[model samples]
Target: MLNFVDWLASTSGSIALRESLYMYPWIESAHVLFIAIFFGTLLFVDLRLTGYGFKNLSISQMNSKILPLTIIGFILMITTGLLLFYALPIRNYHNLFFRIKLFLMLLAGLNAWHFHRTMNRQGKAWDKNSFIPFWMKASATISLVLWGLVIISGRMIAYNWFDCDKQPQSELVNFLISCTVDPEIYEYLNGI
Candidate 1:
C-alpha cells in the first residue's frame, strides 16, 4: 500500500500541486475552511444533545435544518483533505500526528455511528424534550473531545519534531514510524 501510494505521490499531478507556490496554500485554506464548517454545524447538534444550548430547537428540527450543511461540510472537507494528502503522501504517511489523527477519526466515526443508530431508533420519543438521556449526552461529549483531538493531531502533522529522519528515537518509535534508514546515511546526515 505504501509503495502504491508512493508511486501515486510521485505522479505529475501530485508533484505539480505540491511544487506549485500558491496552489498548496489555497488547498490548505479550503481544507481548513471546510473543517470549520463541518465542526461548526456539528456543534449545534452536539449542544442540542447535551441540553446545554439550542434548547428551543428540537432534535428532529435541528437535524432537519442543520444536517444538510453538515453533510456538505463533511463532503467538501474530505475532498480537500484528500487533495492535500495526494500532494504529499510519504511525509504525511510517516507522520505520527497523521496516524493519531486517523485513529481519532475512526473512533469519532464509530461514536457517530452508534449515536445516529440510537437517535434514529428513539429520537421521536424524546426529540422534543429539553431533557436528554445521559447516554446521548455522554456520546456527544465523547464526539466533541475526539474530534477536537483529531483536529489538533491533524494540525500537528506540519511539525517535523518527530520526523522519521530525525534520529535518537527509541527502537519502538522507529518500528512504529518506519524510521529505519541506511546507517551511513543516518550517521552522515547527523554527523555522528
Candidate 2:
C-alpha cells in the first residue's frame, strides 16, 4: 500500500497537481467551498429530523427542498477531495488525522444510509407529522457529531504533531497507524 502511494505520488499528474503554483490552492479552496454547501444543507435536514428546527416543515418537504443541494455539494466536494488526496497521497496516507477522517466518514456514510432506509420504510405515515422516531432523531444527531469530528480531523491533517518523523507516538499509537506495514517506509520514517 505504501509503495502504491509512493508510486501515485511520483506520477506526473500528482506531481503537477502538488507542485502547481495555483492549482493545488484552487482545488483546496473548491473543496472547502463544496464541503460547506454539502454540510450546510445537510445540517438543516438533520436539525429538522431532530425536531429542533423547521417545525412547520414536513420531513418530506425538507428533504425535497434541501437534499438536491446537499447532493450537489457532496459530489463536488468528493471530486475536489480526490484531487487533494491525489496531490498528496503519501502525506495524507501517513497522517493520523487523515486516517481518523476516513474512519469517521465511513461511519457518517453508514448512519446516513440507515437514516434514509428507515425514513423510507416508516416515513410516509409520519412524513407530515411532528412525530419522528427516536432512532431517527438519534441517528441525525449522530450524523452531526460524526461529520463534525470528520471536519475537525480533516483540518487537523495539516498539522504534523503526530507525523511519523515526530517519533513521539507510543507503541499502541504506532500500531493504530499501522506504522509497521512497510518495513522500508517505517525505516525511512524512523531514520528521519
Candidate 3:
C-alpha cells in the first residue's frame, strides 16, 4: 500500500500539481465550496429529521426538495477532493488527521445508509407526524457529530504540527507516517 501510494505521489499528475502555481489552490477552493453546499443541504434535512425545524413541511417533502441538491454537491465535493488528494497522495496518506477524516466519512456514509434503509423504508407514513422516530433522531444527531469531526480533521491536515515533514525523528512518528526512509528522499529532505 505504501509503495503504491508513493508511486502515485511521484506520478506525472502529482508532479504537475506540485509544479502548477494555480491548479492546487483552485482544486482546494472547489472542494471547500462544494463541501459547504453539501453539508448545508444535509444539515437542513437532518435537522428536519430531528424534528427541530421545518415542522410545517413533511419529512418526505423536505427530503424530496433538498436531497437532489445535496447529492449534486456531494458529487462535486468528492471529485474535487480526489483531485486534491492526488496532488499530495503521500502527504495525505501519512497525515493522521486525514486518516481520521476518512474514517469519519465512512462512518457518516454508513449511518446515512442505515437510516435511509430503515427509517425511510415506510415511505411517507411518518412524514407528517409531529414527533420523529427516536432512531431517526439518533441517526441525525450521529450524522451531525460525524460530519463535524470530519470537517475538523480535514482542516487540521493543513497544519504543519503533525505533518510528515515536521514530524520528530522518532520511531513512532516514522511508523505513523509510513515513512519508507528512502535514502534519496531522506537526503533530499535533509538538504543533501
Candidate 4:
C-alpha cells in the first residue's frame, strides 16, 4: 500500500503534472474553500433545525432548500478533500491530528447519515411540528461540533505533528511529534 501511494505521488511529477508546485497547493486550496462552503451552509441549516434562525419558515421548507446546497457543498468538500489527501498521504499517515480529523470526519458522516435515515423514517411528522424533536436537535448539535473538531484537528496536524524540523532523518516519517521548525507559519504560536 505504501509503495502504491508512493508510486501515485511520484507519477504526478511527470510533465503532465508538477505535483508539488501545481497539484498540491491547488488541491489544498480547493479543500479549504469547499470546507468553508460546506460549513457555512451547514451552520445555517443546523441553526435553523435548532430553531435559532428562520423561525417563520417551516423546517421542511428550510430543509428543502438548504439540504440541496449542503449536499452540493459536501460533494465539493469530499472531492477536494480526497485530492488533498492523495497529495500527502504519507505525511497524513504519520500525523496524529490528521488521524483524529479522519476519525471525527467519520463520526460526522455517521451522525449525518443516521439523522437522515431517522428523519426520513419519521417522515413529515417532526417537520410539521412547531418544535423540533430532541434527537434531531442533538444530531444537528453533534454534526456542528464534530465538524468543528475535524477542522481544528486538521490545522493542528500541520503544527503539532508534521513539522519538518522535528521529522527524523529517515526515509519515512511514521508518527506525529511536536518539534521546532524554521519558517513558522504561525508567527504568534511561539510557545507552541
Best by TM-score: 1
- Per-residue lDDT of model 2, residues 1-192, tens digit only: 999999999999999998899999899899999989988888998998888678788888889999999999999999999999999998889888999999999999999998899889889876756688888899999998998998899889889877677665655567766565445655566777
Q: How much does candidate 4 score in TM-score?
A: 0.77
What stretches of model 4 exceed 4 Å from their correct place? 13-22, 160-192
**Model 1 RMSD vs true structure:** 3.0
**Runs in model 1 lying further than 4 Å from the true structure:** 128-130, 182-192
Task: Determine the C-alpha RMSD for candidate 3 after optimal superposition of all C-alphas.
Answer: 4.9
Scanning candidate 2 in windows of ten residues, the lowest lDDT window is 178-187
Badly placed stretches (over 4 Å) of model 2 are 181-192
Q: What is the lDDT of residue 181 in candidate 4?
A: 42
How does residue 128 of candidate 3 score in lDDT? 44
> lDDT (CA) for every model shown?
0.86, 0.87, 0.83, 0.73
lDDT of 2: 0.87
Candidate 4 lDDT, 90-181, residue by residue in tens: 65555667777888999999999999898778747876566767988999999999999998997787674344444442223323332234
Candidate 3 ranges with C-alpha deviation above 4 Å: 128-130, 169-174, 180-192
Residue by residue across 63-108, what tens digits does model 1's lDDT show? 8889899999999999999898999899888888888899999999
Cα lDDT, model 3, residue 25: 92
Q: Of the pair 2 and 3, which is ahead by TM-score?
A: 2
TM-score per candidate, chains pooled: 0.91, 0.89, 0.86, 0.77
